[model samples]
Target: MIDRAIKLWFFSALVWLVIGPAIGAFQSLQFIAPDWMNFLSAIALPYSKLRIVHTNTVILGWIVMTFISAALFMVPRLCNTPLRFPQLAYAAGWIWNAALVLDLVLIWAAIPDSFWLSIQAGEYAEAPLLVDVMIVAAVVCVIASLHLTVFARERPHLYVSVWYLLGGLYTTAITYLVGNFLVLAFSGEGYQVIEAWWLHNAVGMIITPLGLGTAYYIVPLAAQQPLYSHRLSIVGFWTLMAFYPGTGLHHFLQMPVPIWINEFAVISSVLLGIPVLAVVTNFLATPRGNWSRAFDSYPLRFAALGTLYYLATCLQGPFQATAAVNWYVHFTEWVQAHAHLALAGAFTCYGMAAGYYMFPRITGRQLYSRGLASVTFWCMVIFFPIFYIGFTWSGVATGASINLMGNTIYQTINITWIPRLSRTITGTVVVVGFIAYVWLLLRSLRVGAPYESGMNEVPEMGIETPFEEARA
Candidate 1:
């Protein structure tokens, strides 16, 4: 029964995964050729609005849903108990998904006379206040279900993964409230400050911990290894909770908030290195003797590559957060590239690894084809670096032209256009990888190998997991 709810949440994430990236590809086209949007004048979405939808759909719709699914999967296993009210969990997932669909309808259809009527003012907070309330209600229900599940736990001790997942959900509710509601309630400088806090906390508080929590569980389970250090995991968790809130103001350094806020943000952003290092060390260290197995296991591959991307993101984050570096690179294409390295490169892989790792366990079927999984992995592994490098290259050129060479934003176009074009083409290939992932997931339900009595393992997993041994 709990598995049924997990499946619903997972599939919901998959649906949005395909939709978000597909829209993102088209949004990239608006950069190369703004006039191309004229064809969609029926929808009447400008590039800015199109961009908002793309970002929110990916962050809110896809990644956030994936995190919820992760929690649903993790909480039960960690607690050693079935979900307390599986129907409520299932229904909450459906309601939240419906809210997301309504958001898409409201944004794309343009039924409302004013933009604010369709959505809200903030970037990721653009989902209308109504949608936010609906989602908050849905999440509260899910949280209640999850808490009841935890409270009924047979396990005597909680694992670090449980700590992170449940903690993340609570933080998500509060941060979502602050980002969507409190940010809207105030005006003037107060509004700007809270908006800035919400912007960074939306990712740092909500998505980061959830993504990390999922990775912590999936990586060790898929690799069949103990976490590098339980103490380090707790260290990462607490340091993250402490340091992340102050990190938001770093992004809005140019705003005239306060000199002290700038100093606090930079300091905290640098302090963020503590958790980042602890996490990267733990993730990377666990697969020490098993690197060779990664090539054969698609889940392992996703986990491995995801960790590498995490390391890159953490290293880059602290460096770029410095006041000196933030000046020229603030909103440059480099920032865009950096953001994708975390969300697309790292957390997306974590979500994929979780989905692939758990798909068989939940459904009692093997993957349809390791061959297709390879295609999906390699497509992402091949094209994403091309996309990232091309993007960062353009950003560097753009930054130099404007900050160093005294060129206008328009003046940098000739220098940056080629790389931007490369970004579009390569990014589409990466999107193709995600499409293949969704296709393989859909195909597995019909044609994937099914388990029967006395089967040694799920045919897809070459490793012997505890679940497999239990099945045996």
Candidate 2:
């Protein structure tokens, strides 16, 4: 049976996946029709709080929790030992949920006026203390889980992937706590700087490390090959951990942060390309002659796309960080588009790969169908471009409107109705993708088979590797 901790973690992911996006959709619609649901809007509370909750849920509730569970399962297997204190692991899951619940309540209640303003500096003292406490609770829980795994068994040496997984969580815990509470202590303009830095920490230390760890585990396993360059992988991992934390300074380019911060952000961002290339080389080099084989597997396909998007997004990120380029795109839908593409498209794609890899093992069933998985992947391919291009086109139009038309943002937006209209229409395709995902997951859980059924060969890369020969 799948460990109870794993079950709870998956359950958290499923719940937040639905709730977070649903709220985001509501927020998106609020722009199209302001008063259509005035009562409901009021009930949801300030927009900033709602947005924060949604963002936090997606990041903490879904992504972090999912990894926490996956790592718990993987560690024992990698260490070649039975889980130590499995019951404690399950208890930690409950503690995590309770902490998150408190966080949600504090987030909603902290911001009194516009959700937007509360996130600002006016009510610094009144802001949520739960945010601070939640950080502590989260770190403690993580330490417990890791301790259980690390001490459970003795290996001659820890794998590189295991090192990354643990290092990512440990650093993320420290950074998350420091960025939110300690930095936000100063009230005035420092608040913006602190917040921007926090945003950087959230993406850099949290999401980026998690993604890296997942890729390290997934890529070599799928290719049935050891990593191409262990040295390069180690260099890339260390450089990224050092460099990514500063990337947040780019967000303050147009704002009134120190000018040097912007310059440093640009330089570090350019240096990021090195690590990006390193990882890309490692992943792509895996299936050299067997390219078709990896593509044939839907999980690998998603992972491939994720790596591709990661390169694209980082390239865009560095370019956009430049003062000349940002002057045109800052605060425009263009920035939003890139962010969504990177955060949702890139990360979600990788996460899907992990999920597909995990599903059958967790459920003790075979995938329902490969054809359905392929269909879902192709739909993603189509949906991604529509959103990407649509947002880029609209951003250009919006920039022109702001620069040349002498018209305000709201008025200029009306002139370029096609872009907004297309965006909403394209958004429907993403909804379809989510629906397909739900169907695929449910069917796999209920009707799938074991790896030894002549369908999938369970690779020896460790317990986390997905079986090949079935659906993704």
Candidate 3:
């Protein structure tokens, strides 16, 4: 039952990975040529509506669904117990997917003449009231399923992965409800404050916790080692919960909000480095003696590199949150680049690594081609830096032209055209890697090598002892 549920969630996530990024690429093309995708407007859709669809679909549909599948697979195994409610898990997947579809429909179908189905204008919480209700129901099902599984654990001690999974599940439910519903209680300037809070926490609370948690689980396994420091893992988890929630306020520093709010957000954003360092150090240290394996294993490479990207994203985030830096980079391509670094670079890498590691295990089949996987990895490694650097440089140029030279917005856009065009080129190249990845997953499902159970375990590494003993 658990195996069936894992496959369902994972394949569903893959479907979204294909759909979400394709929407994103189209949106990118629209930026390069605004008049190109006019057919979309026939359905009463514009770039503004499609933007939220792309964002929500990738974040919720691809990243969240993939990580939830990982948690479903890992939690029961780590706890040495069966999943407590397999039916609920399965049902939640369908409901979640249905809600996402409804969300897109609401966005695309909305018109001035038919405003009933229109989404709220909130940044991340743009789903209509009906879709929001469905989301809440789906989240409830997920929480109940996971919490019951945790309660039924046969292992006396809970693993750090388990803590992350359970904590992320409940906190995300709270974050979703508050962001989508509670913020509606405020209007005027207060609404902006609450909205900014919701926007940042939507990523910080939901995606960051799940992404880091999945990394913690997958990294050591791919490296064929126990974690370097369990104590560090604990500290990382608590500090993350402590610092991430309030850091959302940094998004509104340029606004007329309270000064203390901005200061606290800056402090929290900077202090976020502690947990990031703790987790990255643990991952890097785990593969000390098995660095060769780390390179040879595609999943380890993804997880390890994802950790580094996570570090880069966090460090840049704090720098951008500072007053002087924020004044320049805010509302520019720099923020977009930073967002992709976290979402596309760090979390997507983790999700892809999870898929690479778990797909074969769940399906009892090998990946179709390691060479293809390597191609995908290298394509991303090459093109993402290209994408990031181009966008960052363009933004800095735009900011400097406007701030230092006192140029108008029109002049800034013209000054940044070359780098902007470079970004479009590199972004298109990155999509090729995405296509290769999706192809790998689909092909492996059909013709990959037969997988023998337990082949992932390494006795010499001493990694299987604790879990095996717990099961016994």
Best by lDDT: 3
Off by over 4 Å in 2: 35-49, 105-127, 151-153, 451-472
1-472: candidate 2 lDDT, tens digit per residue: 2367777876677667666655665566545555664556578665666676767677777677766666665666656676666666677677777766766776765556553323434221223455446545755665666666677666544555666677778877777666656765677677777777777667677777677667666666666665666667777888887787778778778887778888888888788887788778777776676677676566678878888888788888888888888888877888878877776677777777777766666667767888878766876688767867777888888888897676797797686667766666666666567557757777676676665433323223323323221223
Question: What is the RMSD, in Å, between candidate 1 and the native fold over all Cα?
Answer: 4.1
Q: Output the worst ten-in-a-row residue range by lDDT, candidate 3.
A: 456-465
Q: How many residue pairs in model 1 have overlapping backbones?
A: 0
Which residues of candidate 1, in runs, are more than 4 Å off? 39-43, 110-117, 452-472
* TM-scores, each model vs. reference: 0.93, 0.87, 0.94
Q: What is the lDDT of residue 440 in candidate 1?
A: 92
Error of 3 at 293 (Å): 0.6
Number of colliding residue pairs in model 3? 0
User: Which wins on lDDT, candidate 1 or candidate 2?
Assistant: 1
Clashes found in each candidate (C-alpha, N, C closer than 3 A): 0, 5, 0
Deviation in angstroms for 151 in model 2?
4.7
Query: Model 3, range 1-472, lDDT digits (tens) per residue?
Result: 7787788789988888888877777777665565666766665667887798889899889999999998888888877778888888888888889989988987877744343456787888888877888877877887788888888877676777877877888888899888888887999988888888888888888888888888888878888777787678878999999999988878778999889999999999999988888888888998899989966788898988788888899999999999989998888889888988989898889998898988888998999898999987997789988988988998899889988899998788778878877887887777778888989988988999998865443211123335446545
- lDDT: worst 10-residue window of model 1: 455-464
* 2 against 3, candidate with superior lDDT: 3
